[model samples]
Target: MKPKNIGIQMTDKALLFINGVPPENLPDTINYSLIACSDGAFHYLKEKGFPLEKLDFISGDFDSHSGKDETIYHEKFIFTPDQNKTDFEKSLEIIKERGYKEVDVYGGSGGEMDHFLGNLTVAFIFKDDLKITFFDDHSHYFFAPNILVLNDVKNKLISLYPFPKAENITTKGLKWSLIKENLEITNRIGTRNFAQENSVTIEFDTGNLVVFIGN
Candidate 1:
């Protein structure tokens, strides 16, 4: 059976930049969904008047949720008291169980250091089964091994971070080419790279490479 194209939006304990309302193009409809990770995120969504009814379900321990917001969306919320996993991980597990091949995460990186790092690490935990992308107000970050083709990323900032030690890496259409360069995580080898054209290609011979692109 083919995997479902599930879009997972997470509301971590983060500060959102509500710049006069988010664009309508922001995804309001999700085929399978999870919510109530953080009370702050829930409040922001409510303030923006996002469609809460479209969510498949909301799962979270009520530690972060105040009684006020709980009353607002009680019918559609699933209160889970599990303290073992983070809300972000819980949401990913739910999506994976539903057989989603790709998961897009928003509002994951703006909160406390532990939450931000926890959310980022969640990508690796589910990398084999799902393509997870973390998005913030300014950047989109994901890890890809083997070959990655980025189209029309001109004038954008792209950085690569190698994990578990770097291996032979090469780049095409980038300002700097790796050409079998070994980039260790301790060394800031893959930072501040630019795209020379509308498209860019990167290939990693070994190890996981995290690619971050933003303004």
Candidate 2:
């Protein structure tokens, strides 16, 4: 089932595929306002027999997309050769330009560890501007807001990672609940925790908190 979250259910939600490990299952594209992918990811979608006509745009440097592939989808390609920004970031910029505030990303994990870390950094940069959630074979994660509520999470492996640090955290429905506790990367961090109830609530006063819900 599709993960039911306010961020993902928001209007004008976009679906984006990047260059990493492809998702095991492709989500229903009809649920999104727009569907897009990076150049490297397009090959997978094509190989998987995904309907190319449904794709709104394909953004990347197009370093690998050439010859026949380029000719066929030339009109749909948004050539962004900026060496300074990753293709994932460039795609997010395009999504933002199209007035999309929320996006569900696939292929954002696995593969190269450095790329995975870089993707997380990109997500952190756009935390305020975009409601971004990443889905992989293992789990789905997003940068949690001050007041966050998750449903249908009973006994799920839930992790609260401090992007750098978080303060005044209060949580409910977790096996080991935190009451006004602080978390820091260099100090203490919350990881490998489980939900005690079907619904969980997490509240923090400051700092970025990344919530990972095991699938």
Candidate 3:
């Protein structure tokens, strides 16, 4: 769904969204500075009893959304006409324009498989510019490039799946560890690995490898 790496001043938090609002997996409490709604997700929030008054921005092309609720936050709406990008992509642009470095996305899962996979691409697009976590109620996914050391991972399950390809990958502090190995899509994957210690480490020389440490 949406996902992490943490440790920042409490004041410097992230933008939280419900999907179309954009995606993330954030802590329960951290001063949420802004809230966003993407495309049709605006209506999803409304149906679920989200306080529409606190909605700060709405981003997307709005082709799939019914405009009946547009009047609620019309002033906050942003339209990106590019058909190539998804609503989440459109929202991230607004997030960057407003100078936010982190975003936590909720929802955007349990729909179509292609759309869900398309949503995952946002992490690759913004991995260098912004730290975005695409999280639903259950799953947490984050991009791990170069090196990743996760703490507080006592007994959770972790998986290393590459975005097409990753090179010279290595790992430590898990039930199984890799040393200067390679992980490729379809050909080979390191999945169902356990975090044996309190901390787990991963290293890669090139490519985007997403580490999924989940319950």
Candidate 4:
């Protein structure tokens, strides 16, 4: 098993960019099976010269992009104007429809705090259906499954946040490990913890758990 969050080296995963802070650098397009960005993220991709031709599609309401660029990329545009869903959520739907199961997301954090939180919400909504991992300059986060094994993460910062509450949680290879403990947003939360070994295993019984691993 390889380290999942520490690197974005998987060739079978889909790559997605949202309308938050642009990534420090773009990942090699060849490493991804498919690549896409929300309409609001297109400007940053264009400004950063991210090889728009490599994108499989760009999906959103198109409010952030209009006129010239829109006309130029007409063939690549996937218009999703549903007011009920966020662009991030809509993009994930499109990705799923295209038969991609795993996605690596950039620009999912570091803009409006609400958007960051909202993105997490959408991620949680699709947690059972898709393997979505969010990447920022600082770290990578994802909704943890019942059993997760993280390799090569010794001495790195690890945080476990309960989406509201989690039950019967157990962890190994953490400096401060939890054994059948419960974490709650309103009560006890786990953050600023460090891995004690090269590999870490987390097991939990119920509720949503978001795990953040430092880059």
Alpha carbon lDDT of each predicted model: 0.65, 0.92, 0.73, 0.91
Instruction: Please name the candidate that would achieve the greatest lDDT relative to the true structure.
Output: 2
Span of ten consecutive residues with least summed lDDT in model 1: 12-21
Candidate 4 residues lying further than 4 Å off, grouped into runs, are 1-10
lDDT (Cα, tens digit) per residue for candidate 3, span 62-177? 66665666665678778778988777788888877778888877765566777767777876888898877766655576888587889998899888988978999888888988
Cα-based lDDT at residue 72, candidate 3: 59
lDDT of 2: 0.92
Error of 4 at 207 (Å): 1.5
Candidate 3: 10-residue stretch with minimal lDDT: 1-10
> What stretches of model 3 exceed 4 Å from their correct place?
1-10, 16-30, 63-68
Expressed as tens digits, the lDDT of each residue in 5-79 for candidate 2 is 446653479999998999988888767878899999999998888988778899988878669978888889999
- Candidate 4, residues 1-215: lDDT per residue as tens digits? 23233556656679999999999987766667788999989999999988888788999878777689778899999999999999999999999987888999999999789999999999988987899999988999999999999999998999999999999999999999999999999999999999989999999999889999998
lDDT of 1 by residue, 165-207 (tens): 5688888988887898888878756989888878999887778
- TM-scores of the candidates are 0.78, 0.94, 0.83, 0.92
Model 2, position 1, has a per-residue lDDT of 22
Model 1 lDDT on a 0 to 1 scale: 0.65
User: Which residue pairs in candidate 2 collide?
Assistant: none
Query: Candidate 2 regions off by >4 Å?
Result: 1-10
